[model samples]
Target: MTAEIKKQKHVGRWVAVGIVGVIVLALLAAIGWYFVRVNPSVQQVETIETAFPEESLRPEAGEGDGQPVNVLLLGTDARGEGDSLLTDLGDRADTILVAHIPPDRESVQIMSIMRDSWVEIPGHGMAKVNSALAYGGVPLMVQVVEGIIDQRIDHVSIIDFAGFEGLTESMGGVTVNNDIAFSYHGYDYPQGEITIQGEEALIYVRARSPFSDGDYQRVHNQRAFLRGLMTQLMTRENLTNPNRMADILATISPHVATSDTFDLGTVASLGSQLAGIGNSNIQTFTMPTLGTGMEGSQSVVHVNWDGVEEIRAAFDEESMTTFEPPAER
Candidate 1:
């Protein structure tokens, strides 16, 4: 009887130990997953360096005075193998934007440079702003934008449109108001308020053929999409969801190229203010330019230097100028 009792106690001890072991293993797995997903920047290594010849644009870093910060946003169309991010696909910058954060950091100014705008390319002569990236990569692209605006860009971020749909789906969907009814790319998007998924939102912004205004209308749509996306990202549910956060990071991780010194947490915190800026408070406009020009047989968009000064003054916070209402298609 004594031996049986001892054996029973030993069995119980082993069972308890097994249960504890399982619980510990589960907890460890969860922690590993959290780190892997949330701290993507930890694994962010600039492993791939393209052989594309580096052109000198002399991209300057932040002024270090804690004044305003300017960041150039580049949307690239590079595609194919070994080029998870944009590469040798003859990719052009489809869209370009400059975000100027004031000294107060309370408000942000977002200015979109028309891709078609012709400008003097540093070391490459005159060409469209988009072509600057294709012709000489990031370095020249930076120089072209800085030359036009007359203010040095502190940093830059390059984004890819390929995984945008996955990002939208992860958010459950995003909604925006359409001021005018228009149809393009086999999608009939009506006027007023409408919800959009990843694919539909892409179509809305990329629809240039159907509108008479062409790229002008497309730029407006891109701004609208960005606003809606920012709002969706800040919502109670999206902000808290670990899965959504992972998906959002995964979507952009491959395409984005930022300065090595950039900090993810700092940007996220600062972005909250920019995101909260109401659509009414924000202004969207394109750099004025002649329709198009030719550079020794290549077509390009001509830049309007006078308009460039107006942009510089606005970014400098020099004077209050009336913001032109966003035009609808």
Candidate 2:
């Protein structure tokens, strides 16, 4: 063969390989964009602006030396079958939790507030804490929580229980330690490590009738399941796999609504901040409350005034590591 013909053959082969590489790169980019589009749109809460004074706002992470970030995580029940995962203001918040990440970001402290805690809801007189959402939506709920804890709430995220089902299913399921054996709604849950998925996970958090303590046990179960879920999410397999993580986020995103200040960037930053924290380092406690009693015709969990000072001190100091719940009644 002539030298020119040999050179042409070599160059043509190189050109063909380059073309295939470009096509493959383009395909990967398109796949990534599709997953990005799957991210749920953020729903803004306009009234949050008027909910509290500017001075009451907690500084965002990376401000100055950085400060503890307090996020209000709310879980609302399904309005009905086939309801959208993103719950509306009309629905009552069944599970209210304050997830506090300290300045060091070495640990996370989660405090679950009883939904039926009798409290003074801003502009709504005294009512169940959860009623704040019904009166003025997320803003009012934030105000009510701020009033009770005396701490500025920096961000908020609300998730429908249906999202829990999707998230659990996507992750293949989660295993939670059940301290007590109980059966509810035809599902038997033994006392030990229990693996649950989809609808079973929803029922796990919603089951309150089987225990004499009622919602108290239910709250514990929710926290346990949440810790388990977080553990699973942060595992090497899940975190390193972008597609898997995206799938899990996509499943829950549609059913999630956040404060106007919260966005994908905020989510990423917070995740990075808490990445060092592990399940053992994360502590969960229920807000101090007196035993259940009647307030009018409704049963309510009375806020324990004596224990509030301890909680307030820890919150004010951002020292939840030293805080302890009051002894159970």
Which consecutive 10 residues in model 1 have the weakest lDDT in total? Answer: 45-54
Best by lDDT: 2
lDDT of candidate 1 over 1-329, digit per residue (tens): 69999999999999999999999999899757766776774354232343222334443444555566777876666655766454552436677987766666545566778787766776777666777767777666767777776667666776666656656676667787777688876788899878887778778877788777778778778777766776667554655566766667766566566654345655655665454454555556667665665777866666667666766776666322344523322
Displacement of residue 97 (Cα, Å) in model 2 is: 1.2
Local distance difference test, per candidate?
Answer: 0.66, 0.74
Q: Over 4 Å off in model 2, which ranges?
A: 1-63, 78-88, 318-326
Per-residue lDDT of model 2, residues 209-260, tens digit only: 9999998988889888888887777665665566676667767766766666
TM-score of each model, paired residue for residue: 0.75, 0.79
Residue pairs with colliding backbones in model 2 are 85-255
Clashing pairs for model 1 are: 118-301
TM-score of 2: 0.79
lDDT of 2: 0.74
